[model samples]
Target: MELRCKVFLRYCTCFAVIGALLVWPAPVHSAVVVIGARPYLERVAKRVVEILEGRYISGNSLPIADYVAPIQLTDKGLSITGNVSFHSAFLAKIDSIEFDAQKFSEIFLNTEVTVQGALKWHGIGVVLDFAANLEEYNGTGTLYVTYNQFDFPLKVTKPFNSTEPTGSLQFMSIDNSNKIVTVGYPNNKYVQLISRAIMTNFDFRDYMIASFRNWNFQNLLKAVIDEVPFPEVCYNC
Candidate 1:
């Protein structure tokens, strides 16, 4: 009888432990609830912009350095070669950013970028070889270059076991009005000459687009998204 009582007590204790375990509250993870495609994408875009504002955008300038490789283009049987470089450069301002999400995996981004800094160029043409320098701080020679309709294609990937999504943004295209707005008096004639050469021979739009595309924000985006709780399964997104 004693042995039977001991076994019965042991069984009761195990049952009590199991019951407690079953009633214990488990840790709950929050998730994002994607309702509509556009709304969800807008949320993502806002988050992305917030990240950009924190990392790239500071006060009124975006610190950057851009370069254009030596370009060779022929015009009217004239060989033209040149390279443009932007040093101590900074994006003056971002007029606007528009994000169009085609689907959960693809997005099209468009923005207008204004950059200011020291602009240097070297050009060799059939008639003459010239070089120029334009600095933002130079009171006599400051130029405002605008890259309009800067378009980029973004590919989003959701890795296995990762709730957050990462994006790869690539340079798709850019259109420049080819109008260099001179803000100050001209101090160097070579600046104008090289600017004209760059406008005519080299595609400065491509250079700007390539430079912006090189800024990889995949990890930054993922980290930001991870912090925000989204539904594990987005039915609409």
Candidate 2:
């Protein structure tokens, strides 16, 4: 009877310990924002700039250095600038060929971009670069893509299309407070390049417009998201 009582007591103690363990609250980890995120986003932004440089200014395009200046993070997204220069060799080529009854050679393209929207994960269905409504985006920018280093700032409106190749119809936002980012693209958009130079017979408008089309903002946003180490649960995101 004594042995049986001791065994029964041990079983009771084990049950009590197990019950306590089950009822214990799990530890919570707070979401990290602005402080730990900015530098990472900046690095991503620089990489994006490099990719754009490769697409627009490399190889047979231009031998000059494509400069992507520093970026500024905003409430909805971020803003960035780049210096696109045409080297003397490119200029000489342009001078050699007569495009529109003019000697077209040395040029500088200074562009400003403002990207706004949010990043959302729509479960496991096609996780990369999902599309939100066009109305949800506020992505837009100005183009100083011109000749002889002329600063012709053209307002770029939304609804970017491959046909028009002037304005873009994409919206993206970066919310560090909520620890979330998003991108929205229109199925079809007329990216209007409203410029006085176009009316003044700027023969390079088409080339400038084409270059604008090559700047893929979506890739940039993707790079930024990929760089950050978000928690698996993403309770805050």
Candidate 3:
């Protein structure tokens, strides 16, 4: 009887352990590390550039708000005050784009873009509180701007309660010289003066950076990459 009771107790303990093993939830494998991620990132960058170029060509160009700046300067006892306004501005075309993948989460982009718009400048010569309209210039033209080697850093975040990861592309660290803006206008003293004044007062680089910062390229990239079956390794399992 004693032997039978001991055998029965051991069987019950085994059944309890088996039941616990069967009922407990399995560990969730939530982390994955991408292998050879550079090529994939390069592809994603190309696709994003293509999409942006296509969109710009298809009449979905980015619209710029009307910009107005007040210009004031004094040289050789000559006071000049003016107001410059740029209107109907649009980032009309993307001529070319080049991508360099520096790392799995960082990319550098070089692009040439064209901005078409109209500008008006009204200047007054102020002498001893007496102001008179000296020059009023109005013109329409295109600005060819080149951005060289601008950094796009990828940021990934996972919510505390969510398993899916979210990503974003951030624009960062563009050299002022790299943001080159050139326009062709008739070579005249008045035009030259206006151009110099406008260029001095208006920051084209900041405007371009602001426009790019507003765009979310990660969504476009994810749309293409999600369909691809890239090799990955398990992480934090």
TM-score of each: 0.51, 0.24, 0.54
Candidate 1's displacement at residue 190, Å, is 3.7
lDDT of 2 by residue, 31-148 (tens): 4222323233334334444554446333443232222222122223522222212212221111111111121121112322222211121211001111111222333333322232
What's model 1's lDDT at 169?
A: 50
Sorted on lDDT, best first, the list reads 3, 1, 2
User: Worst 10-residue stretch by lDDT in candidate 3?
Assistant: 121-130
Pairs of residues clashing in candidate 3: none
Query: Candidate 1 on 1-237: residue-level lDDT in tens?
Result: 999999999999999999998999877775433334345445656666676656655442332444544544554554434454444445655555656554233222232111111111111011111222233221223344554455555444444355555545544555554543322125454444444544554455445445555655667657655664443343233
Q: Each candidate: RMSD to true structure? A: 14.9, 23.0, 12.5
Q: Which digits, one per residue and each the tens of the lDDT, describe model 3 over residues 1-237?
A: 999999999999999999999999988866444455556555655666667666644433444455555556554565455654555555544445556443444221232111111111111110011112334445443333333345556433333334444445555555355244444345444334434453454453354456556655666646655643343433553
Ranking by TM-score: 3, 1, 2
